[model samples]
Structures are given as C-alpha cells and as structure tokens.
Target chain A: MINKESVIHTRNLSRSFGEILAVDRLSLAISRGEVFGLLGPNGAGKTTTVRLLAALLQPSSGEASIAGYQVGIDDQEIRRKIGLLPEAPGLYDGLTAEQNLAFYGAMYGVEEISQQIKRYLELLGLWNRRHEPVGTFSKGMRQKLAIARALLHEPEVLFLDEPTSSLDPQAARLVREFISDLKGKGRTIILCTHNLEEADRLCDRVAVLNGHLLALDSPIELRRRIFGRKVVFHLSATKTEFEPILLEFDFVNHVEQIENKIVVAVDDPDTHNPVLIRALVEAGAEIRFVGELRRRLEDVYLELMQASEGIINGTN
Target chain B: MERIKAIIIKEWREVFKNRFVFFTVSFLPLMITALPLVILFFTGRSEDFAGVTTADLPPQFSSLCSGLDGAECMLYFIVTQFILLFMMVPVIIPMTIASYSIVGEKTTRTLEPLLATPVSTLEILVGKGLAGVIPAVVATWVGYLLYAAGAHIIVSNPHVVNKLFDPLWMTAIFVVGPLLSLMGVSIAVMISSRVNDPRVAEQISGIFVLPVVGIFLGQTTGLILVNQEFILWMAGVLVVLDSILFYFAVQIFQRETILSRWK
Candidate 1:
C-alpha cells in the first residue's frame, strides 16, 4: 500500500546499461519526514537507484515522482525541488568554500544567498575556513562543505549518497547528529550507505538491494521477521526435562538446550515468556537469569544477503 | 539566465587560477602584437630599402600596394602578412581554455553535481562557450589596439598605417575573430565531453588550427590574396560551421551519455 503522504514514489523503476541491469523493476515509496536508508554491497545498484529517483538518469522502463513532479518528464521541476550530494563531494578545489556554496546557491535560485551560505557553513563548522580553497581542506572538511552545499537551498528532498562513508568517528558522529537534527525538523532524506549500523540507527526504514529489492522494512521488524524472537533462559542446570516443559506451551515454536541454558522461540515473548518461566520453575528448573537474545542488524543483513545469493546461485 | 551567469562566473574563477590559461591569454596576444611592430620598426629604418622601387618587388605586390613607394609598400606588405596571425590569436587562446572545461570537470568529479542542478544543458554550453570566447575576443581586440597604436608611432608613412586599418583587416579582427573563437570553443567542448584526459582533448583540438594555418601559408606564399570579399566569405563560412558544431556539441553532451559512458 502506498502512503498518501509519500513524498517520493516509484513503481517498477528500472535502469539498465547495455547488457547489465543496474536497477531492476524495484518499487518503493518513502514517506514525508522519513530517513530512509538504501543498503547494498558493491555493484548492487544503490547509487543507480538514487540517480534514478533524483532524475539524474532516466529510467529504462519505470516511473518515479519526487514531490509531485514526475521523473524524466518534469526533471527540471524535480531538480528544483531536490538537493543531491553525490558520492565524491565533487567540489571545485580551486574555489573557496564560500564561493562554492554561493555558486550552488545561485543555481538553486536561493534568495538571501549570503545568509543561507553563512547558516550552513556555520552549522557545519566551516565558517572559519570559508575563505580557504577546497584543495587545502582535509577529507572530512571537504565532506562537510559538500554537505553544506547540499543543504544550502533548504531543499524539500535531499538525496545523500554515502553521507559519512570515509570520515573519522567524530566527523561521522557529527554528520549523524546533523542528520538527526534534520529529521527533527521533518525533512525527508534518502541516505545510501554501506555502514549497516549507521543505517540501523538513522533510517526509519531501510531497503536492502542487490540489483533488486531483497528486503524492505524497519531494522527491528526485519530482525523479528527473519530470525523470530528468541528468549534465552539461564539456569543452574540444563536438563532434558526442561525442554518438554517449554514444549508444553503451544505458544512456543521451538526450543533448544545448550548445557546449562534453554533457548526458546516464541511469537510474542512478552506475553509468553512468563508462562514458560512458571512451567520451568514447576519442573524444578532454577532460573538464574532470563534475557532476550539481542540480534544486531548485521546479522539480519548477512542472512538476507546470503539467502539472496543462494537464490541467485540456484542453490536455495 | 541567472543560472547561466553563475556557471560563467564559476568557470571564470576557475579558469583565471590556471597559470597556463593566464599565460596563454596574456602573453600570446602581447607577443603577436609586439612581433609585427618590431619588424615594421626595423623595416621603416632600414637603409637597403631606401632606393628599391616597386619594380624590384614581386609581381603580386603591383596591384595590392598601389599608391605607395618601395619602402612603404614593403612595410605595408609585411604588416599585412601578420593579419592571419592576429586571427590565430582568438583560435589558440580559447582552445587552451575550452579544451579543459568539460574534461577537467569530469576529472575532478564535479560534472555530476553540476548536471544535477536545475540548469539545462544548453545553459551550461552557452555559459562555457561565452567564458572561453569572451577572454579570447578581448585579448585579440586589445592586441589589435596596441598594434595599431605602435604602428602609427613607428611608421613614417601615413599610407602604411592607413592600409593596416583597411576594411579587410578590421573585419578580420572585429568580426571573424569572435566567430573563430566560438568555433574553437565548440570543437574543444565537443572533444572535451568525449575524452577522459584534458591533455588528450587539447592535443586533438590542436589539429583544428591547421586549416587556419594553411590559409595563412597560402596568403604568405602569394597563392591566394585576401581582400574584403575573401574576409566576408570566410566569415560566412565560419558562421555556418559554428552553427553546425554548436549543434553537434549539444547533441554529444547528453547528460546520460556523459555520466555513464565518459569513464
């Protein structure tokens, strides 16, 4: 179901380069004020998808719209409504930071251009070095200046390809925080990144792609859907008898015993864990500690990618 | 229009910082202006030409240097040979700059972001074309002005100076100079859009100057005499060629082809 409030919408968007299909017939919608992440490995069409939706490349056989403007047909109107920070930070190294922003600002038809430039530069902590040519700037500094350039026009939709790909922890954290701040302001951002942890934190939802949509959902939901809720119960002793006690409950889907612990998979752990604990206690099982197994997004991503690879290899 | 202006300003800012571009635009014109004046200065002061008559000159000079004495006619003929060199100024300087424009942007990875903007392809081509043409045209005009000033100061015969400012040479400088610069810029831009290396683009663009040099050779060898009719006809041919090249440039510089194929 497509949300009525979706700011970005696409249906069967596909793009191909001669013999290779960069982006398949992928369809997805991004709602307003959502931070959506596009995650995929090398040659997975993450960048091509962004380019297609940004109207930088025409779709081979699909349709997309940004802020009510159709892609390809209304490319200029869409371009006017969006800001894009390409993968390279693509700045003029010979020009000063201020001059660079001023150039982009003018291209976007931004009014009060100086004020807009000052605001973004100061926000990115680059105002002090605004006069310096970008050639002298460090990698992190150039990335920040590129970010400032992307946000100078206060675009309605921003497509950032690897926003924090090659930055120090501090710089990456600064960018992450800035993205959070933008989220708070109700700005819609489509982020493309290889850092799954970053995507898990920043994205309201993420789409994992390998030339086609492999999976799309919130991180936690995907975790739950892929590797259902597993609750681990630690006890003084693990006996074969505890397994049957957990199996006694119809709510428990599976149970495993590992030496001194019991791992149980349930549909709703919050509602079913207590009943299983009571049954285990009655079975003379001493529960020392009971905790849910925490799964990282990395695990989910690896599982999905491996499954997709198996399907592609005809081994699934 | 404003977006085009922004691109032009940005291009000028970047172009001015290139030392090679600065040297080409500044020094080449100065050299072209001063070289002819120096030769005229020496020819006007030479003692060997004191008694030489038009009878001593080649047959081709009989009709071209009509009212002048032998020395004056010799100086006028020598100065006329530099007219084609003056035309080469606009062609050479803009080629140096325009050859680097698109290919340089691709090398630096700035083309994608610039193309992502609301500005159209035509605006970018126009902006870049004007950026190259303006400087080359300005340099040629300034060089011509200084040459004229120095000629009037150095020549004793007013007729020689008058002949230097004839309709043929004036049209060559004022009219054909800009059109040739535009043609050079269009060809360079077209080549720049396809090539990966700016040096390769420049090297290939250098082949274009041969035709103009061929004309210069023909004129100097007395095989073809340039006059008002020839200047106007050349301008007409350049106008047609500029339009065709500009159209092809726009066709070749497609955003999809550039972002995908120009690796």
Candidate 2:
C-alpha cells in the first residue's frame, strides 16, 4: 500500500537520450520529511533521476509524482511545491545575493517576499553578505545562497544534487548541518550524490543505482545483509589459542586470529555474543574487549559494484 | 503574469548592471545618430560645396532639397539616407543584449534554476524579449531626438529640423525601430537557445542588420526611390515579420528541451 505520507513516488520511471538509457525503470516511494539519497557513481543516472522528479526532464516512460501531483500533467503545480538545487549552484553572478533570492522568490510567486528573503538569508548565515554580488562569492557561499533561493518559497519537497561536491571540509560540514536542520523542519528531501559517506550519514534510505536500481535500504541493513555480522574481540593472550576454541561453537560462523584480536563472523551477534563470551571465558581465554566491528559503507558499495560488474560481464 | 514581469525586471537589472552591455546600450545609439549629424555639419560648413548643386543630386532626393542650396541639399540627402543605417542601432543593441541573455545563462549554468521555477515557457520568452526590445527602442528614440536637436542646432536652419522630424522619419523611428528590435530579439532568442556559445549566437543574430542595410542599398543604388510611402511600406513588412518570428520563438522555446539538450 502506498503511504499517505509519501511525498515522492515513481512507478517504473525511465528517461533515454538517443540510444543511451540514462535511467531505466526506476521505482521508488519516499515518505514526507525523509532524506532519501540516490547513491550512484558518475553516469549512473542519479542526476537524471533528480531532473525527472524536479520536472526539468520528461520521463520517456512510466509515471512519477511529487506531493501527489503527476510530473508531466501537473508540472507547474509540482514546480510550485518543490525546490531544486542543481549540481552547480547556478547563481546569477551579476546580481547580489539578495537580488538572486528575490528573483527566485518572485519567480516562485512567494508572497511576503521581503520577509521570506530575510528569513532564508539569515537562516543560511548569508544576511550580512546579501548585498554582495554573487560573482564575488566562493563556491560554497554560492551553494548556500542557492539553497536559500531554493527554500525561499518554502516548498514542500527539496531536491539537492551533489550539494557538497567541491566544498572544503568546513563548508561541507556547514552544508550538511543545514540540510539536517531542514530535514528536522519536516521538509522531504531527495539528495543525489556520489559521496558515499554523505549518503550513509544523511540518508534515511539510500537507493544504490547504476542505470538501474541495485540495492535499496538503510546503510546498516545493507552492510549486515550483504556482508553479514562481524565482531572483533581483543584478547589478553594469543588469539590463536582462543580462535579454535571459539570456532567450536556451532553459532560461530567463522573465526580468524590476528595478533591480539580474534575476529569472528556470526549469523546474529546480538543473539550469540553473550554465549560466545562465556564460552571463551570458561575456556581460560581472557577477553578484554568485545564489540561489533564497524563495517564501512564503502565496502558494501564496492561489493555491490563488483557484483553488478560481474552481472554486466555475464560472469555473475 | 507576475512571473514574466519578475523575469523582465531581473533581465533589465542584469542588463544595466553589466558594464559591457551598459556601455554599448548607452553609447551605440548616440554614436550612430551623432555620426550623420556630424557629417551634415561638416558638409554645411565647407565652402567648396558651391560647385555641386541640387541638380547633381539623385532625382529621388530632389523633393527633399527643394528649398535648399547645394550644401544644404547635400546635407539633407546625407541625413535622410544615413538615418536608415541608424536602424542598425536598435537591431544591434537589443540583439546584443538578447543574444547573450539565454546563452549566457546556459554558460553560467543558471538556466536550470530559472527553468525549474513554475513560470511557463512563453513567459520566459516574452520577458526576455521585452527586456531586449524596451531598451533598444528607448535608446533609438532618445538618439533620434538628440540627432534632431543636434541637426537643428548645427545646420543653422529651421527647415533642417522640419525635414528630420517629418512624419516619415517619425514612422521609421517609432514604428520600424520597435518592430526591427522585436525581430532582432526574436532571432537572438531563437538562435541563443540553440547555440551554446554567446558569441556565436550574437554573430548569427547580427544578420538582422543586413536587411536594413539592404534597404539602404536599394535607396542608394536607385533600385527603389526612397520616400514616405517607402518607409511606411517597410514598417508594414516589418510588422508581419515580427509576428511570424514571435510565433516561432514562443513555439521553439521548450524549457525541458533546452535543459535536456544543453551541453
């Protein structure tokens, strides 16, 4: 059943350019206020998907909607209800920051524009520089201004594509925090990015795409489902002595002794960790620390890429 | 409707704020108009002009020089003929501004955000078209007024003012100038949307001046005798041409198409 709170919904959406299929049969349902990330590599149709949903591109097939408005039929209405920050900030460099925001505010027909512009400029920490020409602003500052431009009308849904591609660490963090705050305001967001860490940290559910949907789930769920559970135990004594003893437990899927740490792969660490700990202690092995290993999303991403590659090469 | 107005205002602001566009839009009209007045001034002053009489002038110019001597007749002929070339001012200025408008947005990567708004394609087209046409038309009229004043002062003849501000000249400046400006803007809009580079779009739309020059050529070569009726007919043809170009411009302006095919 489609959730009533779903703000973005697509049914087998596809777009093609000449002979190239940029996006193919992508289906998704993103709930209101959810920060849904479309994760992919370069040329993986992430940008294409964002354009389609934003009504900047027409799908070659299927259907999509924003706030229950169909993409093609209700394009203007959809546009009115959505804010889009394209890959480039795309600021009118000749205009001052205030002018740019005001232009967009009027373009979106937002009433009380002066107050809206003031509110957004202040919220984005750009009020002091509002009078400065955007031509003089740095990439990050232009991006923040673009964000404020997108939000000036207070759209219900926001789309950001590669929001922090070229920013310094400090600027990237500021943008991330701003996006997090926007999410807190209950505005549904669709973030398209190649930055795996940003996606892992910010997305409630990420759709891994490569011309087609590969995997769709939370980061932790993807890691656990694809690579299983792994726990590393720091032992006071040689790990070799504890490895074989710990391996004897039927619940322990696999064990490896590396220096002072015994790494164990298990079906369910939450269920078997206590039993494994008692067995190790009863067997005269001193365990200092036992915790689930933090699996990097990069690993799962790479693993999925490799699997997709194999499938492409007909060797999967 | 408000969206179109906003876009027009934004475009006007951008045109004024851009130093290069500002300089050209401000000076080109004065320069084009003032050149003819200067020539008329120098010719009126030269004493050697006694050798050439009104009979030596083209038969088509005979009516304009009826009350004048050799120098004054020569001045009248030059002023009237060169004013046709002044038509190039409106064509170039508006076309220059409109040519760069869309393609410049594309280069700066600003078109996406503008297109992402709720504004219709026709609104964007009209806003930008008017942005280009309004300034060009204003400049042309102001330049014509200045030229008329300068001619009246420099030539030291009240009839010179009478000849320059004739009903025909008024029709050309008021009717032909705006329609030609709209045509230039329409061409620029059509070409700019297709081209990625602003320079290329400007160059292609620069072809607009050729037809005005063509009329000048016809008048110069005696292929067509220039008169009030000729000017009125030209304005009529321009009205039809402006309408055709406008229809195609709006039809060709697909927001999604530009966003998709843009490089």
Candidate 3:
C-alpha cells in the first residue's frame, strides 16, 4: 500500500487533446523511498503522467504536488525535489563526456560542480573518455551521461523513463544497481518502462496504466489477485484417446492434451487430477506427467491490459 | 545569482564550442573592418568610396571633424552601416540561441529534466537571455573595432585615428545595442516558451526581427530621418517595446503549460 510519507500526490488529474483524453483523472500517492513503476503499452499515457509530475505540462484539471509544492505555482521547489530522465533525451553532440556533465551540473546549480562532474564521469565509467565528444561516445555512454545529468543535483525524487533502453547487459545491470542504491537512501522514484522483469525486480508497487489504471498493487498482490490457483498435473497413460476423456471432467476449465500428456486448469485441479487419472485408466488411455504449473509476471501484465480494455468498455 | 552565473558560463562555453555559433558571431565583425581596407585598395589609398579623396573634401571634414578627411568620411559611412547591420545580429543570435534554448531541449526530449530543476522560469529566461545577448553585444563592439583599425590604416590620413571614435556611434552601441538585444532575447524566449517544435519556434521567433530591419531600411532610404532627436525618440519607443515584450514573455512562460505542451 502507498503510505503517508508520499512525495508525489495527484488528485483528479486529467489531460485532453481536443477530443482525445490522454490522462483521465489520474490520482495516486507515491510514498517516499518507494520505487513505483508506471507500465503501459505505447500511447498509454505513461509518458504523459511522467511529464505531468515533472511540472512540464499543465493539467486540464485537478492538482498535483511534489514535496508539498503545487505543480505549476511552486514549480521551483518541486523541481528541486524531482529529477527526470526524459524519453529520447539527446546528448550535445559537440561536447565531450566531461564537458556535457559539467554543462548540466552548472545548469543544475550543483555545488562544487566540477567535483560532481568528475564523480559522475567516473561512476558511469566514462572517466577514460571524459574528453571525447558525446557524438563519438557509444549509445551506452550517452545514456550514462544523461543519467549523470539527472543525478547532478542530488534530487530527492527521480523520474527514470526507459533508463536501460539502449544499454548493454552489463551497463543495464549497473543502472539497476544504481537505482537500488538510490532507493536505499530513502529517495522516491517513478519509473516508466516496458521491461516486465525489471519492473518485478526494482519496483515496490506497479500501476498498469492502459487508459486509466487497470490495476494498482505490488507485483505479488497483483499476481495472486488476478490469476487464480494454477495446478499442473502430469499424467502418463495409454495413448488411446486420452484427450477426449480429459474433456469429460466438468471441473476442467481448459485441457490441452499431447500424446500421452495433458495440461488441465480446473476450479479444483487437485481433486480433478485424481479423477482424470482414474478415468484415463478405465478408458485404457495412457497417463503421463502431472504437477503444478508455473505462472509468470507476463501473464499478469497481459491480464491487466485486457482487464483495462474491459474497464474502458464499461465492464467491471 | 549563482545559478545565473553558472548558466551564463555554461552557455558561453556552448556558444564558443558550436562552429555555427562561432561563425555567426565572428563573420560580421571581420567583414565590417575589412570593407574599408578593400575600398582603399581599389581607390589607390583613397579612403572615400564616394570618389572624393580626403585631400579634396569639405572644410568641415578637415576642420570641425579634426580627424576626418575625404577617406575618413567614407570610413564613417562604412561604420554607420556596420552599426545598422550589427542591430540585426542581436535579433539573429536570439533567434538561433533561444530557438534551441528551451525548444531545442524539447526536441532532444531534454526539456523534462530541465523543467524538473529548481530553477524558476524567470531564472531560466535570464540565463538564456544572457547567452544570446552577451555574444551579440560583444560581437558588435569587436567588429566595430576591427573596422576602425582597417579604416585608420587604409585612409593613410594621420588624423583619421582622432576621429575614428564618434560620440554618436558610442551612444548607439552603449544605449541602443542593449535595448535591441533585450528586444530580441525577450521575443525569441517568448516564442520558445510557447511552442514544442524547435523549427517552428525558430521560424516564428525570426519574424519579430522584420520590424527592426524595416526601420533600418527606412533610415537608409531617408524615409525616416535619424537625427539625435530621432535617435532618442526611437530609443524611447524601443524601451516601451522592450517593457511590453518583457511583461508578456514572463507571463506566457507558464511553467505548467510549457511542461505539458512540451511533452
């Protein structure tokens, strides 16, 4: 559950572009020290929400605050608390790695900007090429410089958009590690990404924002609440027509039968599995493997998207 | 103040770093000084391009204006035109620099992080205006100096240096230059704050300079006389324009609107 020490609070926030409603009354409280993930498909308003929180956009209606400051009115104070890594942020192609950092640091008004510039360059492993123009740096290096720019002011809240989009495996790992480090320091974070695995790993709570919020909960709560019990029963038996025999069981929701193998979903698969085995032997059908199935975060994500589509069509 | 200083320093470095910025700033000054030298070369050490040598010029040129001769008069024409041309640069730099200041960041998608900083819209505007204005004003003086040096050498008149500096030109640079620069910076910044597309902002911001150029043409064609009274009147008019520009530019710089439309 989102707690009382929320750094960001949005109330009935809505944005409409002509007839198109981009964000519809999006209201949520993000507590301090939590990593909140905003997951949605392309054009699902994830990016819009990030921009709103960053005080970059004027809401059509409603209100939002960062660190107790209103979005637009007290913009400077809000900006002080939040740092954003914008989507598709480009590098100054003519500036070297160190120069870019120094430029941003100065713009951010980071104290001892030169020292911070050195620290960030070294942290991102761009120390070796600190003098090389960002145009000459690799994609991973550019992204790293952008991140350093984000952190230059040491903001209390961070908004990371697709933070690991272009990184190599090692680089992605380093960013993830850095995020964990930030969270450990009690800094709030808002992340917009499609990486389901990363979401499961890094976030404390995730909101599936399709058009409106389809679901909002911790990953574990979502998985448990959305998907019922998954029971995988392995049955080996005579290969003669076992598929039809398995379908006869009333409790079976879906039955996929392979030659001498089957996967079944039932309200009570535990009770149903035994009955299926007995029926199979009676019918002289072969029974193969039987056990519980493993459910993944992907399944939960898809189900949430579908549920949201239903929500849009006015189905509960 | 610290933030402003930081922004100005960083912006100065950026202007120096970009080849386009360097060229735009330096090209005019080099041309300004070199024109008189070219005329002297073609006219056989005669500073006057109007075909009247300093030796045969009016007594006023050789007496009231002690340093002025036939060639020095021609040199004055060059400098005056250069000053007029220099007025255009303020508008130009602001267009290029302000177009990229915020709108460029939006295009790069860096506007998000920039907006997320603790800096106010006013602070941001001040920082950006300094970047565009400083280079433009400095370039005008640098170019004028080079022109004066070339004129002094080419005129070959020992007295030319004495009249190379004029009270009128000095007043123009010190007074009108900053006013015009502020006008440019303000209008360009206002345009940048409103739009998301850098190209569109650049184009829109650029149109504001037409009136200034029109005034220059009017003066050139004698449609408007630019006596001391006229200069003072026009300066007053520009100050009013500058105030209006400053007021709306700040008002239209709605942080929420920019942030929202920016995305």
Candidate 4:
C-alpha cells in the first residue's frame, strides 16, 4: 500500500552525457492514482526521462524524488517505490518465464518470492508454459512477463515505457484494459508511448511533449481546445418524416443528415445539446442517445502538429 | 548480508544453469590438471616416469626425485601442476568473473536494475569473486583428489607424495590462489564495467594474463624459480603490484560514467 501523500517531485532535474543533453531541467509533480501520459516523437528525451526516474542514470543537475526521496541522494528508495517496464522488455532471454520473474523479485526483495512468481505465472496465463524458456515465447508473452515482473513487488508508482509497442490488436487491448483497471485503483502511472489512440483511451491527462509540452490536459479537454466542440448523434428514428425538424433548432451552428441521424457541430454544446434533445422529443422522433462528440485523438494530434508548425512559421 | 547471500545464490544458480559454464567451473580445472596424469598413468611404464633421465634433468630436479617411483614421480607432477596450471587458471578466473558479472547484466538488461538495488558495487564484486572462486577452488581439490587416487594405484611408493604436501603449496593453493583470483576479478570487473561489449571486455581482460604467463615461462627458462629466498622476494613484489592493481581497478570503475554510455 502506498501513502496517498507521497508526491513525485522534481525541482530542476537535468541529465547530460558530455556534449549531448538527454533531459534538461524537467520539473513536474505526479500524485497518487493519477495516470500521467508522457508523449514525444522519437529522440525527444522521453526514454531518458524514464531512465532517470528509474535511477538507472544519474542526473547531471538538480533533483527529483519518487515517494519524496531525492534522485541521487536516496535513489534506491525511489527505485523501490516505482515499478519500471522499460521500452524494450528487460528479461533474461534464456531463463524460463518463472525464472525471469524470480530474478526481478529477488532484486526487489519481494517477500514470498516463489509464491509471487506463481501468482504472476497464473495471472498472465503463462502457467502451462512456465517451464519453457523465455527465448521461445512470443513477443506478446514476453511483454506480459515484463509487466508481471514490474508489478510483482506491487510498486506504488508504475513507469511504463511503450508497454504495448509490439503487441497485436488483441494483446494491445488486453494491456490497455489492464492499465485502465490499474488506474481505477489510484496508482500513479507515467505511460510513455507513441500510440496516440492507446494514449487517449488510457491516460487521464497527457503531456504533448513536442520539443516542449505543447499541451497537457484530459483527452477531451485537449480535443476541444485544438479542434473546437462538435456533437454527433445516431438515432433509430422515423427517418424521412423527422428529418426536417432538426433544422429549426436555434442553438445548432450546423446540421447534416447522414444516413439516419443528425450531426450537429455546436459552439456551446453544453447549453445547446439539451435544446436539440428536446426538439427531437417534440418532433416525435424516438432518439436513442444524444451526446457531445469531438475529434478522435488522431485528428486532434495532427491538428496540433499543424498548429505548432504554423506557430513556428509565423514567428520565423 | 542477506542481499549478499541472495546475489551469491543468484550467481551460483546462473552458473549452474548454463551447462558449458557449469562444466568449465565445476570440471574443467580438474580435467586440465588430472587428464594428463591419467594419460601418463595408463600409457606410462613405471620406468618412463621414474627413470629420472639424469642427462636431461638439472641436478636439483633430479635430486628431488631421488626414489623416482610411483608416489615420488607423482609428487614431482604435483609441483609442476602448481607452477603451470596454478598460474594459468587465475588468468581465466578474472575473465570469467568479470565478463559474467558485468556483461551478463548488460545482456540481461539487469545492470540498470541491479545498480538501482540497495546492494553497493563492492558487495556485488564480493558476490562475483566468490562465485568465480568457490567453484575454481572446488575444482582444484577435485583435481588434487584425482591425482591422489591415481598416484596411490599407479605409483610404487605412497609416502613420498604425501611428504611433499608441504605448507607452501597448501598455502599457495588455499590462500594465494583465491587472492590472485580476487585481483584478476577486480581488474576484469573494472574493464567490464567500462566496456559494454562482453567480447571486448573479455578481450581486454585477456591482457591481464600476459604478466603471469611471462613469469611462468621465466621460471621454466631458468631465469627465475621460487626458492625460499626467491619466493620471499617475489612475495614482496607481488604484494606491491597487487596493491597497485587493486587501487587502479577501483579507481577506474566509475559507475556514473559507465551508465551514461550504456547504449
């Protein structure tokens, strides 16, 4: 059990290797039970940030703490508090699935070590193949074992670096579901990923790490900020007779009839959606649902990139 | 201490897990030391080993084999084993310990997680050295036991070999053997930590063997031999050299520098 009071703090953390600045003066706070997504394009210092947090690399300047222990000063304490699943799964290739877990569990001093190994072996549905060496396991199985190793010690904070990078759609869904279940329990998670769709589904708030943080907000908040608010409705309707009724609503900025339902892109949908809903009711249309719909993360992210490029062009 | 025990167990288990490594650590020294003697026993007529070709051997070596019978000839073989294999094994000892300790972690990607653990670098070194050493020493004793058995059956005399089991070789085997291994392992570890490529570390660590091999040949060539006075002088030289190497190895093994370069 982690103390809810524990705060992941970085005062002015920085890391450099001679001429290369890997991470620079990153200061941020992550609280218990919040899933904070870290996003960046390739070579944008995301992995370096994860390594520093894991204390696998020492900071060149300033301090950061996990569970209130300073980066270099009390690094082991931070390590103990956080569960790290690195980008490439760090597992002993020749060892069996069980043996791989044992190695990590021993490192963490996890009590009842063998018992925990058994638990993960069963939990990940790898029990039957427990005796088989990990080298022979599929990529997805190996990744699940990596996640099991990370979670074996039941760490308070979890740092996941591209946890589902190599999985198939089914395997990816399973991992996303697991992450979602974990967030409900209030574990502080820092998910580092390039998969925009996956990040939108799993992250409570995401930091758009484009050279610097372009935006940080819940997925919905970010979409509305970048692409404006819109609503789409799919209705089981008296289709031809009810089609004309949606045009008279004063709150709707625009409406389009595609197939059976009306699509409305509204400026103030909070107040406008209700008026549309009532108009449908008065029009004798049996509306199944009415809700605000916005740009999927795919569109929002591309728009963000375009906006950032535009900003750079105008300034230059 | 618990962490030390865990790491040591981990190292031993890993060593045992690999058949090639386990066989090398558990049986190679014994084979290298005893297999030649076994061939000599099966094919050698008593006269071949015991004849003491006075024309070929120096007076000192000839005189030491006065009886030149089974046990007596075996005693001479034991002394030879000490001079050659004793030194050669230590050379590889450092390579195995260092490469396995550092490179194995890098291969497994356990290096980062291990460095993060509560265990300090020195403690990890102790675990590594012990893992390399205990097996090496056990293999040495196994070799000695095989020699004892072969000599008892093959030799005409039993007491002569027993008499040559003096305090010096015993001390060399028990005390100095592990010390030399520790020195080698420490140096190898420093190299391994600096170099990410295991093969490169192993190759670089192979440089440590040159001095030992040079001394072994110098002795065989009659340029040097460990008589009482000479042994005392060499002891003094070795102590000074080992101290310097020890200090240098520790100084070069900088954790921060290595981690930054791990690609």
Task: Give the alpha carbon lDDT tens digit for every residue of A25-82 in model 1.
Answer: 9999899888899999999999999999888899999899999999989999998888
DockQ (0 to 1) for model 4: 0.36
lDDT per residue for candidate 3 within B1-263, as digits (tens), equals: 76677677756665466566566567655664566457545653442355667666434334334445455565554434445655676667766776666676666655556666677777778887888888887877776677567656665554544444556566566678778888988888888887887668768877887887887787666575444566677689889999999889889887666655655
- The residue-by-residue lDDT of candidate 4 on B106-184, one tens digit each, is 7667665566555566667667767776666665656665655565565535454563355545555555556667667
What TM-score does structure 3 among the candidates reach? 0.81
Judging by lDDT, tell me the better candidate of 1 and 3.
1
Poorly placed runs, candidate 4 (over 4 Å): A1-6, A232-267, A275-291, A307-316, B15-27, B35-82, B151-155, B228-259
Could you tell me which 10 consecutive residues in candidate 3 chain A have the lowest summed lDDT? A230-239
Best by TM-score: 1
Q: Which ten residues in a row have the lowest lDDT in candidate 4 chain B?
A: B74-83
Tell me which residue pairs clash in candidate 2. none
- Model 1, B152-176: lDDT tens digits are 8877567888987777788999999
DockQ of each: 0.84, 0.78, 0.49, 0.36
Give each prediction's root-mean-square deviation over alpha carbons: 2.2, 2.7, 5.3, 4.8
What fraction of the reference structure's interface contacts does model 4 contain?
A: 0.32
TM (B chain), model 1: 0.93
The CAPRI classification for model 4 reads as: acceptable
Off by over 4 Å in 3: A1-4, A166-170, A233-292, A311-316, B15-18, B40-83, B100-102, B156-161, B193-225, B254-263
